[model samples]
Target: MADNHLGEFLRARRAALRPDEVGMVAYGVRRVAGLRREEVAVLAGVNADYYARLEQGRERRPSAQVLDALGRALRLDADAQAHLHRLAGTAPALPLGHTTDRVSPALRRLLDGHPGSPAYVVNRTLDVLAANALAETLHSPFEELDNLARMTFLDPAGRLFYTRWNWTAQAVVGHLREAAGHDPDSPRLGELVRTLSAHSADFTRLWNTHTVRGKTQEAKHFLHPDVGPLTLTYLALDVRDSPGQQLVVYQADPTGPDAEALTLLGALTRSAAL
Candidate 1:
């Protein structure tokens, strides 16, 4: 059988949607989960047979207009809609295959410049390419800080480190799904997903959800081993020169106790090196 990612995605999303969510009365006992294929076809303004064909992988090429309609019907967000388009070969593709792990001198300098903030560079597969002292200190609890997904799912410290462990897991899986949509041919990504799936049941469950999202600005909560609770806001910026590379920076409120804790964390790292 062909590796039908598009069909799989469509099936997952369709199964996730509920009748009431789309203002349809779910009459009688339903055998299947979420909306049926015919319901989605009606909502998307497409023929039932055509939609079935699309989901069965018989039809691969979908027009932008049809995709837009389907996106609306499925209640996809901006990122997911783009991902759908990319999967259908309608949108511009992202950088394919393994991205370079090397971080530029300028980028390293930039990371170091943010002395008060914790900053790190990660690729599509959540591999940590490089990190500043603060960033390293912030994630010191992890046995292996190489990959965020591995850290989140495999590391013993992950549950203790992330205050909202479930939310972090969901986000990580969703981001991975988006990455898969971008570079379906990436061996590294495939390996990472396989490893996570084999090891972590939580990762496997979220992976099956087909949630697609990119890392944007978000509030992250952490329980630092040394400093207790720390809540920080992080921003994920794309590296223009390095495709699939994202510079993630975390900041605490300047006047808050979290900032003081961050400073203390930095001091601990510096002291350890002394």
Candidate 2:
């Protein structure tokens, strides 16, 4: 089947929007949930047929102005708008194929430096390439910390570990969506999505939303079995040497209870090793 990511994205965004949200008044019984094709065309200042064609995959090349107009019509945020451009071929897509999963030694050393903090590296697909001692200990509850998405939805411990599972799930899907924009043709990503969709209804729901996000910076709350509750702020930085790898560092204030919990967690890890 011909992949129509652009069309799927447009349709998903359109269905997610409401007429009243865009200052459009409903005239009659609408068959669909969101604005009609004609309505979007009117708002975007493009011909209705042209808009329809774009959504139907008939019109592959859309000008930047038209894309900008469509973005406005869909109420796309900066990330979603960038995704739209990438889908439309207006922006440079990310490097294709599987990005190297190996973490460089220097990067490993950086992760080691954060003994008090939990630091790990993940690829674009959210695979845990490498993690420091504290980082591994933080996610030790999971059966496997290989892939964040899989562990989140597939693993039973995911729900128990993450205090805010819904928010975390949304962020995971958004990150995957952003990755999709980069490599729409990636088989590895395709298989992951397929497996996730097959097994996880929540994954299916959020995947359909077509929301785009990256694992940039966020505060994560975890309920560790050994250490109790922990709230940590994490920063995700893209590794300059590796195209798709990201170094994520989780930190808690030294004076805070969360930091104490982290300390205990680290001690527990050491005890287990011993």
Candidate 3:
């Protein structure tokens, strides 16, 4: 796999954009995918050789102004722009030991209070650090649901559980890629990546795409064996004072069938616990 993450990301992002998408007219029989390196250099107002050097990993430490121009030229979204800055080494790196997997007492209490919604906490490596009863019930299909990436890629039941398996897989991989960039030396993250890369070809393919994305809000589709199909919206909140931990909560429309199924599932889970 390509270890030059900055170069890899730049190449991927550049390949994802087209000339017409950026208001450039396409000539007949274009050979390259997306915009050419020279085209990007012209659009970003930099010399073509300099931009080539940037992609070749020979030139690092691009100025803020140049990064901004490149961000615009690439037509990057807010998240992608932030990722570009991080790859360019413009963003401040978090010091080692600053991140923790521990969930606070207050956060645990908050998760317990959300009986109607499925809530859980995950660290940077997507390890299930803490989870409420409903969350556990929701993910009960997986034999080992401790890590989100493992469940998404390695588990046989993942395809059955996730109605949109491809989307879920991509999201999981993208989130992990973003986390890896943030904390490259994380032992847990490295181990997980190595294990998945060895076992799962899909995981290896997605990991090489060099996509970086953080989960914020997204509609999820789950086909629970007990509850049937469910359409839920999830919100992932960054836990305060916990650098690597995220509190994710899932909910369905109050008047929908999913909501009714969730209620039944909660009751069943609570009764089973007794």
**Stretches > 4 Å off in candidate 1:** 94-98
lDDT tens digits by residue: candidate 1, 1-274: 6778898999999999999999998987888799999999999999999999999999999899999999999999998999999899999864454457789999999999887899999998999999998888899899967999999999999999998999999999989998888888789999998999999999999999899988877889999989999999999999988888999999999999999999999898788779
Q: In model 3, what are the clashing residue pairs, if there are any?
A: none
The lDDT-based order of candidates, best leading, equals 1, 2, 3
Q: In candidate 3, what are the lDDT values of residues 1-274, reduced to their tens digit?
A: 3356677777888888888899998777767578888889999999999999889988888997998999899887777777888777798867767888888999999999988899999998899999998999999999966999999999999999999999999989988878867866568888999999999999998987777778967899999999899999999998878887899999999998989999989998999899
Tell me the whole-model lDDT of each prediction, alpha carbons only: 0.91, 0.89, 0.87
Candidate 1 differs from the real structure by a C-alpha RMSD in angstroms, to one decimal, of 1.3
lDDT by residue (209-274, candidate 2, tens digit) is: 999986666789999888899999988898977888899988888899988898898887678778
Question: By the TM-score metric, which is better: model 1 or model 3?
Answer: 1
Ranking by TM-score: 1, 2, 3
Count of clashes, each model: 0, 0, 0
RMSD of each: 1.3, 1.4, 2.2
Superior by lDDT: candidate 1 or candidate 2: 1
lDDT of model 1, residue 133: 89
